[model samples]
Target: MSCCSPEGHCSSAETAAVPAPGTTTVYTVTGMTCGHCEKAVGTAVSALDGVTAVQVDVTAGLVTVVSTADPDDARVRDAVEDAGYELAGRATAAAH
Candidate 1:
C-alpha cells in the first residue's frame, strides 16, 4: 500500500533517506485506526535518533522504520507506547 498520510502525499519522516549501513524494520503496532493514529505512531518513531523514515499502515497495523543504524527494539516499543499504541513486535525487514 502507499505510504502517504491519506492526503495523497508523502508524509512526515516517510521520505527521509537512511545513511550508509542503515537498516529498515517493520514492526507490528496495534490500536491504530485512522490517519491521525498513523501520524502519532510515525512522528514518535521518526523522532528517534538514527531514524530516517517512518511509514504507518493503519489498515495492517504495521510501522515501517528506516534508520542509519539498527533500531533497538526497546526504543521502538517505547515510541509506540508513547503514541498510545502497543508494539505487537517485529514483523519483518521493511520491504523496499
Candidate 2:
C-alpha cells in the first residue's frame, strides 16, 4: 500500500529533533494537502526570526516550530497566509 493519496498527498509519518535551547510551539494550519504544501509552509515559517526549526505534519494539519523565544502568533499567521495556507491558531487540547 502507498502512503500517498491518488492526488499525490502523502501522509507518511515525520519527526523533528528537539531543540534544547528553544521553545516549541505547535500551530494548526489548513489547506496543506501535499508535500509541496508542507515544503512551502516549512520554508516560510523557518525563515522567521529566532526560528530554529520547523516540522510540518500535513495529515494532521500541524506545524511545529522551535525558536529561541516564544514566537509571535501574528507573524506565524502571516507567514502561513503568505505561503497560501490558513493559520488556525495554536494547537490546543480542544484542537485535537
Q: Each model's TM-score?
A: 0.74, 0.80
Residues 1-96, model 1: lDDT tens digits: 544456676423242333444587888888887667777888899999989888787777878888988899999999899978999898965522
Cα shift from native, residue 81, model 2 (Å) = 0.3
Summed over model 2, clashes come to: 0
List lDDT for all candidates, in order: 0.78, 0.86
lDDT of 2 at 1: 36
Candidate 2 lDDT: 0.86
Best by lDDT: 2
Q: Pick the candidate with the highest TM-score.
A: 2
Error of 2 at 2 (Å): 20
Q: Per-residue lDDT tens digits of candidate 2, residues 36-83?
A: 778789999999999999989888999999999999999999999999
